[model samples]
Target: MTAPLQGKIAYVTGGSRGIGRASAIAFAEAGADVAICHLDDEAEARTLVQAVTARGRRGFQMAADMGEVAQINAFTAAAEAALGPCDILLNNAGMNIRNPFGEITEAEFDRMVAVHLKGMFFMAQAVYPGMVARGGGRIINIASQLALKGSPGIVTYCAVKAGIIGFTRALAHEAGPRGVLVNAIAPGPVETDLTRARGPEWKARISASLPLGRIGQPEEISATAVLLAGPGGSFYTGACLSPNGGDVMH
Candidate 1:
């Protein structure tokens, strides 16, 4: 049987760990060659590349911080050189610093906006022309459930994530005409380094409040991403799929 993504090329940001790592592996397993970028953590990136290669698919890794436009362009160039034009682009690189609204500094807020909102916008811009030329492609941005329902101590995070959704929608309108589907994935509390950084108490409290009674796994999130990037997502664009354990039901 042919894989849904056979012969495709995928590019994933923040691919060193967590949802990004899992999604890259999943794409490879589905028969797509993958190129992933990380801010740092060469070891984790190497492991991801190995895992994808082990799946009998080509894998490439680059160290690039998404917060910088030049770095994003460089990473995309490297990916194209190594793997070819991207069929699926996953803008998942992000960071967070939690502090009370009054305590959060200007720099901290700027950092969050740069990484989440600015990065997502330009990354999409970088790949869009190629996608248009190819006649079709997929762009998936990783948002958060907090974007839908505000959270204490992370106002900047919430704002930027919300911006991601807006960006996805607007970009989808422009790109969809050119055969590029743009979407966002808003996940709830997941057992990733980012979420675990909130500490055990936060995790426990969140889990108790969630309908699933537990934080989600990276694999679960990755499955949703794979579906978005594969043939199954042919008709999906400008949609925000929230796999948030029922945290925010609309």
Candidate 2:
């Protein structure tokens, strides 16, 4: 098979499981070395690392909470040391605390902001220089349909995701001349730990309402990430791809 990402280094945050894990494996399958970050899921990260290696690519994992600036910086450095300069960055790390807007505490709201919005910005900043030095690279941010349509009890989550889209567009403009492609993926109801946390019954009800009548799979989302990371995405930048089973039609 032709290696689209051969000789490249790809780093994915929160890759121990869910969309992050799927994207990391997809990048590896395309022939890129992978560096994955998991806050406290080293064991699962190890399994993912082994899987990436098994695909005939190099894989490394680091433990770091993306919500913390210090940890993110350290994680990036560790990944660089292990995987060389990053050629593709998948900013898949994010968290959402569901609660009525009136019940959202300052600290809880802050955590959501720190992890989803703040982390993506700072993480991009940390990796942009390397990508520019290399002449070109891809930065794929995982957003949500809620960010577009908004959702109850997830106000802060939606806010952060909306911020991600804005950030992607702005950063795309800034990074374009430098050869860095910045884009965001707004996935709909998907079957993952994140959705499970939302409640299984609620997950089903949401999926049933979708045109596709089914929740998305991690692998399905991973395919999109592959396109954004490979030659197929050469012309795509500053765009948000909605893989939400036709839920949020334009």
For model 2 the TM-score comes to 0.98
- For residues 3-84, write the lDDT of model 1, one tens digit per residue: 9999999999999899999999999999999999998889999999999999999999999988899999999999999999
Stretches of candidate 1 exceeding 4 Å from the true structure: none
Q: What TM-score would each prediction reach against the true structure?
A: 0.98, 0.98
Error of 1 at 180 (Å): 0.3
Error of 1 at 4 (Å): 0.7
The per-residue C-alpha lDDT of model 2 at residue 74 equals 93
**Tens digits of lDDT, candidate 2, 61-131:** 99888888898889899988887988999999987788999999999998999999888888888889989
lDDT of 2 at 103: 99
* Model 2 local distance difference test score: 0.91
What does each candidate score in C-alpha RMSD?
Answer: 0.9, 1.0
The C-alpha stretches of model 2 lying farther than 4 A from their native spots are none
Going through the candidates in order, what is the number of backbone clashes in each? 0, 0
